[model samples]
Target: MKKKKMISVLLTAVMAAGVLSACSTGQSSTQNGDNAPNTSAGGVTTIEFWAAPNPTQQAFWQTMAKDYEAVNSKVKVNVSAMKESPTSEAGIQAAIAAKSAPTMSENINRGFAAQLSDSKALVPLDTLDGFQDIVKSRSMTNTIEPWRFADSHQYVLPIYSNAMLFGWRLDTLKELGYSEPPKTYSEILELTKKLKAKYGDKKFLWAKADLADPTAWKRWFDFYMLYDAASNGNKFIEGDKFTGVDKAGLDVLTFVDSLRKENGLLARQVTDPFENGVGTFVDVGPWTFTTWAEKYPELKYNVNYTLTMPPVPDDVDPADSKTFADTKGLVIYASATKEQQAAAVDFIKWVYSDAKNDAAWFEQTMLPPARDDLTSNEAFTSILDQHPELKPYAENVPNAIPPMDNAKYNDLQTIIGEQAFNKVVKGGITPDAGWANMKKAIESALK
Candidate 1:
């Protein structure tokens, strides 16, 4: 699971899908809190929680909020739903711009969290009780450095992580003579080629690209994970800094171009694994699996897909097959009342620590848990244990990294993708020329 995301393009898609597509809730234009006193007349705390606009998620979240409210009648929690489909992220910006934001919401990335943190929009949770313990548990088992999340204070908490793993038809692989997933990039390419030759028109594409920036960018990042992270001084982050666009960046884009232009082993930008069935192997996450499992049950049995880490570079450590995980978490807003914020924290903690809370979420959703103790919880172990092919891909998780978050990085990537990536892959220019153009565009953006 390598890290890549196209936020701007996707944001616009959201706009087309209508501002109301993801979730249906009331509209408010400011960070309004509980102006009303408690029923006891002692004190009242109210906060608004903005989150992914998924309708399925609404039930679980609202239930949790209601429970919290029951315990603290003085504390009111309004969980506003905004669909991410058409333009959910925009609502965040729009609400903030209109000065009508909720008390708590989190729209984060490893690189972008700082922007919000610096603006004082997010509260520091470092001083909260059980925060350090939660950090330790998450760090050791998940292999994520908790300190990596630290800003001036604790702006974001570690949430469930998602990664891009190889999904394939298990029976098809065996029919093609690959008893297991390949261990290297070249191996997979070779395997896919053999399968392509056998299937002829029925292809086992490595991946498909989407105009949506995140989907397109993730396809690129997952390809990079097939290489060595430190082979030629590759490191996504150095201490508290982002370190992309060196040999790793070059090697990443080079491989991507090679995959599309040279190999032709991947499906095109518009192929959907669910609708078209044009591809065999696809890159996706757990949520995608859940969607497929539910929305298209007829295709479920056909999807014997599993996870495998991106291959190690030829010269690098064989054991270091890391995954690129870009997932979401909960962050309280600075505007939230202390009691309301505490209530939010309590809801979050219960999910991470209590079995009942964990069960409710798992029953409601198919998310991977953030804590290891909870991995044994029925959600992961059952399906994963039965599907061993998913094991190899699961190895990449501990090493997951977030994609670049700098605003300049975003603009530079867009320019490079438009000028170099799309052009080279679609055969508009020579690879060398495309590389040079990308380099120039990025440098200009930096300046």
Candidate 2:
């Protein structure tokens, strides 16, 4: 009953050709060893694990694999970075088609996991033994609640949840007679007026090309963050149903339209605008701290800038504001054998059973571990103390919402930018018209 055809259509002709060329050249990330889900001699269950094509991530997984194998002699995990011919997703699709897919892989986001689940490419992680144990041991009960797919099964075990926040130029806000960043739309508009009066059009509220790009993933930083706050974390889409709140969505569009009218937005591409003081505000992630510490050390947190959740509507409570969660997780492939699946779950359980491992993950990756008690737990106190910039992320872990679990998320998110957000920012459409148009287009596409 599996629909492998669905996955086959995911990659375009150009990407598929690249995958084929890479495979022929022995450039594929999957090793030449037997990866067909087989148990080796001595009843050892060998599982291949594809880590994200990142050096830090690959190094972490390789170390973990060696440590895990030392404790559990019956299971062997070969960790390798996934090939990114053009993208890691394409490489995974090629592996599945060639029957060389790893037993499990990390770097699986909720939206992409929905696609994999629809094609029956992933095992329902909730059905696996030790699933609840992992949740309890990792202290991620609340954090993992939103990861359930539409099918009522958990497909991905979330590793990190980057609670996206907005960073404001603290010096700029002080210059505008404010002590902290604005947390509501009305407050932001007032700040915008003061900003324009001071800097004219030379500076913008936000200077980012992604605002006008209409790229699917770009919506995560701009649209989803604000929409989540305005909607009070309402679901935009649920199981092929358009569940977006009309009032909340329109409020977000209207907020953007007002900023555009005030010349507060600069949709053109600008490098390091926030750091260079060309943009007063921009979406901030925990991953950005390391770069800032090295390259733009002058942009100190709470000194030169400060982070806050996305601005909410005037009527919404700013204290309860929510934002998009930039998260990814681990998923076991359905093609794996029963032995391999069991072993994979066992490895995950062992990895998460100790809070020290989570602390190590946080220290090494700088990505906040997906735990509800990140700020409260003593294990993470040292890391947060060392990296104070990440404290806001740890505190707001529960306030971040994961992306919609829809197989058509790519099309759905693109529609949000193309029909509504981009149009409102460009003055091509009224907020009301943009909202109506986007809703119609997205609902039509959902069907």
Candidate 3:
């Protein structure tokens, strides 16, 4: 409770401070006129693009900007790393409050984009010209459908989606007389019993400290992953409504509770539990392979480990399971001029029209491109051949569910952990009580 309250107070303070700064600087709450229409005297429309503050992402955008400028002389793209004062989101918020936000940025998630859109700070991408062309050309219609906001507007152009998966120690499963990892709750429970009967306290199905942490983002890898799979990608929140499936949420909590009963969960602070083989199963993302290559080279894909979507409920089809998407995308600020907006969209369309660009992105950054044909596209075949572990993520891009498009997603997700998931994991509450309390709290929060 203190942690949540403290974070709320800090965010409030930051926003308030931004308002004060704007007022002191003689700036209005609205965008300054000088920030728009940054066109050169030569009739070239200039758009500022703030890339995510990372070396690889910055390099990718910088290269793309140079390449784009070489072909199209009418548009100028200036790429720079987004400022991260404490955090990138906070920096963006501060910039918006001061009315100096970039023309477009590439690190926006659906939830934060919702907050921006609610304040009318974002331009709806779907309403822009040539938006459908980009969708058709990139072959991302199905993959981009879930990104639509409650207002039926597409505010973001998703670049990469890291479909969350579970990595199981295949060697350990083999030692337990299993060739593959379990895919359903009952199957996992049965495996848990055998694991306990053999290794006792030395092994666990999952050993992650974040399970008991009430941090908002922690829910993505644990609760949301399982809940999405169990519910088959149900949108837990649509706009301001708490639309989480009751049965799926309860089943997820109950599954965690079941695992706890079998001594299959360890929500304690254990360093590198998955890599060290202390935990047989843990949430995996495409980004992990980079670290594995440098540190745990022995963790070969399909050799000693395998990746699959989060396990589903007993009755749900494991083959059709869905998981949460760790995704971020580009969004144009409404503060930009119409010309700049058009130019930004044109740049996006040009960048995505070619599959080789996406292939380069996948190769430079480990993140999977948000396209439906990634697995079948000849452009990506060689890349997938080099990194077989990424094939599942590519195949499941359409199956991955993005985060809720709610401005209060942080608070809502925290309630899930504090009222339901964390409590159940710690054996402090029954699944029924946890579900009811969580639903009530989330509904109240939504109101």
Candidate 4:
């Protein structure tokens, strides 16, 4: 009851203290390339692109086409997309059955990139002309950051990324006399309790726990990464050469289980969570832009959100609080011919690396830019200006750990979510036993 009032007062006070950030909740940025229908010239090399209509993706292809076409008048590009293949095998199947698939295509970023990596169907992007300089200096730094690694060499062109931190309702925390948000993992637990206890009679609540949404998985991935940011940290995805999983990582995972404990301290929308305030803070991505925020504008004044990262342990280095990164890259299709590659790269590079659309883009589509450069662009300025607290997730890119991965990506998260849910939510297993069950299921599934 007190925490809610404190948060509310703090939220209001923050405005006087200069609380200017975007109030806009963001939509999930998809491979939503701005691919539009284009006519090709006979003498020009035409690259066929098959993708879904991503009305809200960052670095839209259509915008890129205008610039690429302006320079490569001799090269032509054609793009078409269907809906519903996002998590389905249809895209791959369609490619397999096609007379000839698009010379260039959009991938699932990680999973699809992995597929392309496995099938050897994609061109080595680093070999493309002018790629070395762009990747080595600008693109890799400005774009992919640490995500620029390839298993063998440089095979992917990373365009954008995502990370997890924390977001809580400032209004809900005001009753507790808190003026700022928590910065460490242990602090998050304490703050969670504070909010739960503070908001007694107020319409505002603090902190919702995320569960089972693919959009929310970045936080789950980040929680474990808080302990270690290295590629194979926590052994979430074991490579043949590395052996590392620490107690800190286990604690984070267990904490996640704790979020959904049946005693009901946590929040999940199994039946529309945000609607009921099951838990105010949720580990989520931009999807909340449409799901929760747009529908309830008043909620913005009540809740303040930011990315959820590992808080600095009382005894540990604050830098170590950062962990886990979600890499979203652009994958060029292998079937794209030598000639098509020329135009494709030009188009992709221009939008991802150059075009500025925070206002024209996000405002029109209700989405957020994946580019670090545009986080506070005019379209999103109102948001960043008011909610300066979002900086943790926005700024933690450098220390981000990688998103979850397994041979069968879907099956992996499904198993983890199930094991943890069964143990913590269903009362069927202990946390340790649940983790053991997760490891066993993962190993068996791998085999």
Highest-TM-score candidate: 3
* Candidate 2 C-alpha lDDT tens digits along 1-447: 011122222687764565445334432223334443345668888898999877878888888889999999999999999987756777897786575778899998888888677767788999998889999988898889878777789999989999999999999889889998888899899999999999997888988877898878888889999999998888788778899999999999999999998999999978889999999999988878777889998888789899998999999999989889999999998777777889999999999988888888888888898999999999999999988989999998878889899988888888998999998899999999999999999989988
RMSD of each: 6.6, 5.3, 3.5, 12.7
lDDT of 4 by residue, 262-343 (tens): 2324334344443545444444444454556566555553354334554554556555555554555555655454556777
lDDT of 3: 0.88
lDDT comparison, 1 vs 4, better candidate: 1
Query: How far is 367's C-alpha from truth in model 4 (Å)?
Result: 5.4
Report the Cα lDDT for residue 387, model 2: 84
Candidate structures ordered by TM-score, highest first: 3, 2, 1, 4
Once model 3 is optimally superposed onto the true structure by TM-score, how far is the C-alpha of residue 334 displaced, in angstroms? Answer: 0.2
Error of 3 at 218 (Å): 0.3
TM-scores, one per candidate: 0.73, 0.92, 0.94, 0.71
User: Between prediction 1 and prediction 3, which has the larger TM-score?
Assistant: 3
Candidate 4 wrong stretches, greater than 4 Å:
1-42, 57-59, 83-89, 136-139, 142-150, 192-235, 238-244, 257-264, 267-278, 290-293, 301-315, 323-327, 352-393, 402-406, 425-427
Whose lDDT is greatest here?
3
- Which regions of candidate 2 are displaced past 4 Å? 1-9, 13-38
Better candidate number, 2 or 4, judged by lDDT:
2
lDDT of 3 by residue, 1-447 (tens): 001122221247768566445534433223365544445548998888999987888999999999999999999999999987767777887887667777899988888888777767788999999999999999999999999999999999999998889999999999999989888899999999999999999999999999899988889889999999999899999999988899999899999999999999999999899999899999888888888999999889999999998999989989889999999999998777787889999999999989999999999988899999999999999999999999999999999999899989889999999999999999999999999999999999989
lDDT of each: 0.52, 0.85, 0.88, 0.47
Candidate 1, residues 69-159, lDDT tens digits: the string is 7765766677768545434555564444344556666445544454444445556777666666655644334434532543335556645
What lDDT score is found at residue 325 in candidate 1? Answer: 60
Quote the positional error of residue 46 for candidate 4 in Å.
0.8
CA shift at 141, candidate 4, in angstroms? 2.5
